[model samples]
Target: MSGRRLAELLAATETQTPQGGQAVSFEPLGWVWLKAGSRRRRERTEAGVTRMIETMRVETRADPRLVAGRVLRFDGDDWTVVAVEVDAERPGRVRADLERRP
Candidate 1:
């Protein structure tokens, strides 16, 4: 897949209790093909709440696993999906807005 990158969609695949506490494990749904996206820094102000957000715009084939609040592993980092939008120009494709998790 030229002009594309690969990322693992992270999900709460399993759960368990350790020491009477709850814990979860995020497992990879599978390797997915992603169109080349960029790492960007954005500054926004809403209701006087200004913040700098590091974001990524990932374009890929429409996958049911690409849901908001889900995590994606790529480039050795985890990114949280902020939003998903349809790719009007490329039907069957979608653009996922992601924010880097610290």
Candidate 2:
């Protein structure tokens, strides 16, 4: 799909050197058009507690800098990227699977 819709902003976590120590910061990558979907799944943690997790599928234009750990903000909600898959047929597009962070 053409990137004609502005849906979300991609933010990357950056480490900055400030004062005598390092600090973590969120840097805005850019605005991107995205197609999104949601599903619910049950996840078991290390403590053996089962919890419901909302997973989101987000598709957008391909960006080499977009990785699995970055955060995506859309519609006042933040989702963490869990996987990124580049579209094989359409080389300029990428599909990122995301999970809502508790």
Candidate 3:
């Protein structure tokens, strides 16, 4: 797809999921599936950064085909989840930095 097309798609998705979305579980290098209407978790730094920390919700799955990873597929678009850090307290949520893949 063209860069413009991809950008448009992401923008649409962001609007649809303003609260963010859920990221299914997968391995470090495994392919992941991401969809809209998932969930979003947010946090705010009381004094330090003075900005809210937002992240997408992620949940693990027993089946290998359905879990978390650094790569995600959504709406026929592929995105790479970079700087993915798991929440120490919440096992189901992950702080994922998303970037377009290819």
Reference-based TM-score of each model: 0.72, 0.70, 0.31
Pairs of residues clashing in candidate 3: 24-67, 25-67, 25-68, 26-67, 26-68, 26-69
Weakest 10 consecutive residues, lDDT, candidate 2? 1-10
**Whole-model alpha-carbon lDDT for candidate 3:** 0.39
Kindly list the per-residue Cα lDDT of model 3 for residues 3-101, writing each as its tens digit.
111111121122234458744443333433333234334555666865544343333322233323334555454554445455577666544455442
When sorted by lDDT, best at the front, the candidate numbers are 1, 2, 3
Candidate 2 deviates by what RMSD? 4.6
lDDT per residue for candidate 2 within 37-92, as digits (tens), equals: 65556574757776767786778888776788887777667778889998998889
Which portions of model 3 miss their true places by more than 4 Å?
Answer: 1-70
Top-lDDT structure, candidate number: 1
Tell me which of candidates 2 and 3 scores higher on lDDT: 2
What local lDDT does model 1 show for residue 60? 91
Per-residue lDDT of model 1, residues 1-102, tens digit only: 125777888886445577776686887788787875677887878799988877878789998888998888877888888899999999999998888634
Clashes of 3: 6
Model 1 per-residue lDDT at 47: 97
lDDT of each: 0.80, 0.72, 0.39
